[model samples]
Target: MQTSPQAIFFDVNETLLDLQPVKESVAAALGGSKELVPLWFTTLLQYSLVSTVGGRYADFGSIATAALQMVARQQGMEFSEAAAKAAVKPVRSLPPHPEVPAALERLNAAGFLLYTLTNSAADALEDQMTHSGLKGYFAGRLSVDGVQKFKPHRDVYTWAAEQVGADPKDCLLVAAHGWDVAGAGWAGMQTAFIARPGQVTYPLADAPDHTFPDLDRLADALTMR
Candidate 1:
């Protein structure tokens, strides 16, 4: 049986916020090669971990721009970092997933303490939550930038838990990315894997405490508890 958690932490990008607009922007910049969007995102995540493990830190926007440039170069296209930044500029104002508002309302009404735990920088997160109209639902907004590490990094997860005054085990991390779920689980947090379209869990990782197709179902489940 699952017990209620002290707080629920959400991953910002692609979990609560939709990424389709950013994907389309990247595709257009890549000469309409929509196929490269996933590659660019994967590269972005890969290098985030690389920087963390390498004991270096760069803001998420800088890493994303660099990843875009790398993907462009692989396709034999010359892209300036400035161009890459422009390509992914839509990230800051991404809209929430369609069901996000109502689901968050339900969760908030149920008295669940909601907070965002994201890899985006503080300013970027503020822009996103405010632009997406999600700012009112959360009690706190946490950024990995504070710890100088990225998601899937144990330190980041633990740091978020500490910020919210919850034990790692008392926090439930909800994320669309497998790496985020795995990292939170390994850090002793309860995990809910939001298997959003095209998202899947890592095969080698421990299974999440809960799996739901979307936030609607997740809200249904959590509220019932």
Candidate 2:
């Protein structure tokens, strides 16, 4: 098993910030039903991967808007650029999941260097973390924007490790998304899969070094304090 990681890189969005509000906003703007949120989000991820694999670059916010338009048209819903922006604006202001603060505190107290490596742009991630009251617990934050690519792309993980002076094998990625765990595993980083409700690890990927239902349990397992 992979061990002795020198740094921990966290995935933001669903892993930390509660996306329920964003989902509700999406629902209100579209079908007036929250179920559309998952479909829209899945479309967003698909296109993000497409853009990266095709060697095109666009900030995530722009991509989110485009994805919204595509989904709206597919659903025959009215979607203006302004309306799309309004629907997703809540993303910048989401609250951290209930267990996040104390668990991060536990990890920090135990002397692990914690950082966030997100698909968001740097300024956007700053706003989200600051608004969520999670900014101070991390030593730093890295974004795929800096690498001009999205997660599941090997370079993004390698670039994040380089930014912090850690080898891929010496870093651990903690995320709730199966795609993320699979990507990090392929990139040679140890991983902790947070199988939050409705989330599951990728069956085809190598298993995570640790798995937990929530951050609190992960803290209990990893924290020295």
Candidate 3:
């Protein structure tokens, strides 16, 4: 049986914040068609995985830019340095999902220590959190920039746990991505899957300890458990 968390670590992008604006922005920058949104996102994840396997590391933004260029080339679209940079502008200003603030407030009131772990840069994380009025709720924000590895990597979770001075088993990782949840589970942390629509779960090597339709449900489950 999983122990209740002493600290809950959340994934930034789709878990608590909506990335639709970022998707729309990128689509506009790519000539006003939203068709390439999935391609761009997939490319971003691909490069991050490749870099880790090849023992190389790039910041998320750098990888994002490179991936955009690659996707543009495949679509026979001309890539402009300016447009590529603009495509990522939304990352710095994404709004939190509707339930994020309320759920986070409830968690805080319930006395659960909270932290964020993301593939984004520390500054990017800070900007989003501050913009969403959630800066005060987090005890800390952790970025994978230093390690250059992405989710499903044991080292990143290990590093995050160490940074917060918590045992891996004592942390509950709440994320919308199955890979993030799998990674945390493999690292020995209990996992909660915030099942945002259009995302799917896989029969990965490690699986989440719990799954909920949204943050509000997750909060209620945590309270009950």
Q: lDDT: which candidate is best? A: 1
Clash counts for all predictions: 0, 0, 0
| Model 2: per-residue Cα lDDT over 20-85, one tens digit each | 888888888887867778888998899999999999988888788888888899887766899998
lDDT of each: 0.94, 0.90, 0.86
**Once model 3 is optimally superposed onto the true structure by TM-score, how far is the C-alpha of residue 138 displaced, in angstroms?**
0.4
Off by over 4 Å in 3: none
lDDT of 1 by residue, 126-201 (tens): 9999899999999999999889999999999899999989899999999999999999999999999988888999
Q: How are the candidates ranked when ordered by lDDT, highest leading?
A: 1, 2, 3
Expressed as tens digits, the lDDT of each residue in 77-158 for candidate 3 is: 8777677978887887888999989999898888889999999887788888888788899998888875678876999999
Determine which window of 10 residues in candidate 2 has minimal summed lDDT.
216-225
Better of 1 and 2 by lDDT: 1
In angstroms, the error of model 3 at 55 is: 2.3
TM-score of each predicted structure versus truth: 0.98, 0.97, 0.95
lDDT of predicted model 3: 0.86
Between candidates 2 and 3, the one scoring higher on TM-score is 2
What is the Cα-based TM-score of model 1? 0.98
- Cα error, residue 131 of model 1, in Å, equals 0.7
